[model samples]
Target: MPILTGDQELEQRNRLPTLMEVLGRRTLAPVDLFSFYIYMRDQQRSVDYLDFWLDVSQHMSLCRHYVRELRRSMLVETPDMEKATSKRSSALLENFGESLGEAESHPSSNEKRSSEQRLSAFLRHQHKDSSGTNQSPAHSMTSQHSNMNFSRPSHEPKPSPHSEGPTRPSFMGSDQPQTDSNSPGHTVARQDIKASAEKILYTFILPGSEREIVLPQSMLNRIIHSIEEEGRDDPEVFDDAKDYVFQAMERDAFPGFLQAKALGNLVPLSVLIRLIIGLASLMAGFWGGFFMILRSIPRHTRCWLILPFTIGCYFLVSYQYKIDVVAAYLGFSEYTFMSWARIREPFVRKLLLTRAMMASLMFVAAAVALSVLFIFVPGADF
Candidate 1:
């Protein structure tokens, strides 16, 4: 391969259309094109990138121009597409008519043909003067062949007119009294139209990544129009657009954090800080409780030394087990404490609680034993 010169490199860099040109030409969906511009912008960290966006800001109003061009193009192409579809449908109907004509040699086939003709007339009546009506090709064909039934020849035995009771009305023919909106054929046709209209066709580049998002045209249009209207009063509409793009980009992060928290993979710094503060507060409260208990006894008594020593041992045991007195004092339930502790197993949690409670009891027993020993020992002075 040959090496590229400076001019050639510059040409390669400018090969892609500018944001203004892309917006004006209607080559890509407005949102996708803009998002791609943002992705490219985030990658290049230089004054040149700033200048590129500044150039884009000058043509922010070009979005309206592109919308107008799209409308015009649709107006031009819709007639051709409709004409083609109509021709195809008419051809299919002609083929069906020829097939029915071939079967006319049979007497039963003539009755079937007459019934089909009546059904076709009814469909034509329903569709007449309604240019915007869109029905599936299958539904249209089925409607054209509705209410068909074969009859026996006159030579065969027939049921007496008195034996036949009044018949229920048929929904498949024009002679039917009322239209059934909930009929299976109508429902299927409506569903087909809805599914086709909602099908996604456009893919947009997401900000801060090379990934693209696919969505229906209507949804994309609504999102783009909403962003445009929101930024209408702002002097820098491009900045507003950037804000919307980045907001969409960050939408997944929140759900991802929640999933991580559920899986016990996430530990927020704020939570850790809160826990540290709570632990310190609990230590201070324990010291205060010890002081209050000691004040109830004489300060000069030999039991005074035992209180401090026992309290120290209790603090050491509680700290080792990571138990906070404030949690129990605040009337926290087991589930609440489990969440704070981030422990999942009930057995391990119960074991830790047991150890903590035993430590407190041991401290109390030590204080009582020391006092009894002092009282019994001869000349055990304060």
Candidate 2:
């Protein structure tokens, strides 16, 4: 075995090895190579440093064996490193033509400790080179695993039985032998991907406030289904609902209860209350108009009064005040009323006022006419 001279070690410093070279020189299977890459990558070490280690190991042949043994030992002894079994460790040592006993007996405690310190320093140097700041190597390692992709290369064919080595565990503990889709890790990963893809964000603008709501794809699908179901029964309702949703999206405004109804969700209590109030108002107006007409009509002219009173009552009950009241009760603010008041053109205002006054006078004339008929046709019936 060749030994690395002092000058050689210095020359190879701060360089990392390529994945191919590491696999070739280390005689590692693809899976093992992947694990090694993950471990180093998590440590935030550069490819240059990896190359340096590989070069050092090649020159000092004993260095390669020792490093491999050390990694296996770390896996076995360091509880936090990875879940390593005695069988796996033995397999690794056997593959490297070394025994655990021999490895332990040969390297003194000082030498082992020194090697670990050197590796630690190498990692720290790599971290500083990349980030320009001192950061905890262990923390960096722990943080990166969640986001790392362990996808297998498409070009690399599966190993044949003769070429296959012992099944090695992933350093991240996620690579299990089972290809079953039911595996917990795989299921979680699938769910994560689905969740990330399904995330839908909608911005909602209300009076003096803004908010964002995130709906999963499943919820959106349900909403779509609801719309489709509703459409089958009532096309007009479906069209209105679709228009409402599009308008909401365009304006970034979702009025309470109305939006829920548009989405075919349950009508909110507030909306139900408004609907009830509107129905009651219509009923009350109808009854009030009927009684007003009845009181205005004279019993003597009762036969001729029905038609005029019916027409008059219809107009009276459909008055602008009923509309204004309903609008105000349903959250149309003073600002909305002010918008209507802003029509300040003299001609237009006068025309609108004239039209309103004429309607009112017509109603009063119908009542007065009835009274006059009662006076003229006295004793026709009270």
Candidate 3:
């Protein structure tokens, strides 16, 4: 792959709006979407498909890296890399380790973070670097690898797709050939790759495994055979399964993710609609009820005005759903705005959810009270 200059990469990553735009740009990754699903899943843990899809993506990344390193090692003549590889493999396979797709590119967990802020910082730095005439390809790649999706410490070097040949697995960018394929490092990277693939199989692919992803029996057997019998760890081996999960997620989960992350901005519109409708009904009910009682119209005819009032109450109360809390606590102008999905902390999300729940309880209580007033004493016109 050709090295991307800073401008080319900036153009590549500037806000993908559509599914095709995201897929075509190779900028909006599955992790971005899956991470959103995981965020929303904290409210309801039923979103297993997104989590499963993420594992599939991670495994494919590992396999792709494995195959690349394997081919690179094939041309080299090196001494046994067994001892070095053993430690690396153990580390790589440790407890379904972090996703390898762009670990170097993500921010550390402890920071007060927002995905939008990170993306903005990433774009700003790129613009500044691209403005300079003397930028090198290695420097551009390091900037991308270290801080494209998220910011990193400035002192760290750049990283790139092909640059992390297992042994050099970080953004400490270097221009040297990935390995003296003839050097003893040959087997270490490939060995790590193999170990990771096996770990993924045991953790997420095999039947009755700890966290197995749902797949057809034949597909599972084929994958098991590929990893075990044939020892073929490459993107090609998992194409069917990857396509399977990709299609499932695209058809079902993507719609919901898109709705929550994109269309959620319409929440304020819903609130406005409810507020307008509620005010109209509330006015009509109060004016009509008073007008009837003053004119001494039959209680039967005027009591029906309570119906619209009750509906108004229900909508107005339900619409409150703690918008003030969202704005005050989360500093969002709207509850479900895309930036809201950027909140990485679970406790913060739970706090917002709790406040919203309290408002829902108020709506329910108001609904029940109105229902009782109408049912038990419809003729009691006050």
Worst 10 residues of 3 by lDDT: 141-150
The model with the greatest lDDT is: 3
Ranking by TM-score: 3, 1, 2
Question: Over the stretch 1-382, how does candidate 1's per-residue lDDT look in tens digits?
Answer: 5545534533454222333333222222111232223222222111122222322232222222222222333345446666565564444344434444444333234654453443333233323423435332332223221221212323212222322222111111121122123433332232222221121111122222222243345554554453333212111323433344444433533233222222221123323544555455445545544454444434345444555445554444444333443343332222212333233223323433454466557656655664455433434132
What lDDT score belongs to each candidate, Candidate 1 first?
Answer: 0.33, 0.32, 0.44
Q: Who wins the TM-score comparison?
A: 3
Please provide, for model 2 over 123-192, each residue's C-alpha lDDT reduced to its tens digit, 9 standing for 90 to 100: 3333334353322212122221122133344422233232223122222222221122232232222222
Q: Rank the candidates by lDDT, best first.
A: 3, 1, 2
Model 3 error, position 305 (Å): 15
**Model 2 spans > 4 angstroms off:** 1-351, 380-382
Query: Least accurate stretch of 10 residues (summed lDDT) in model 1?
Result: 167-176
Task: State how far residue 159 of model 1 sits from its true place (Å).
Answer: 65
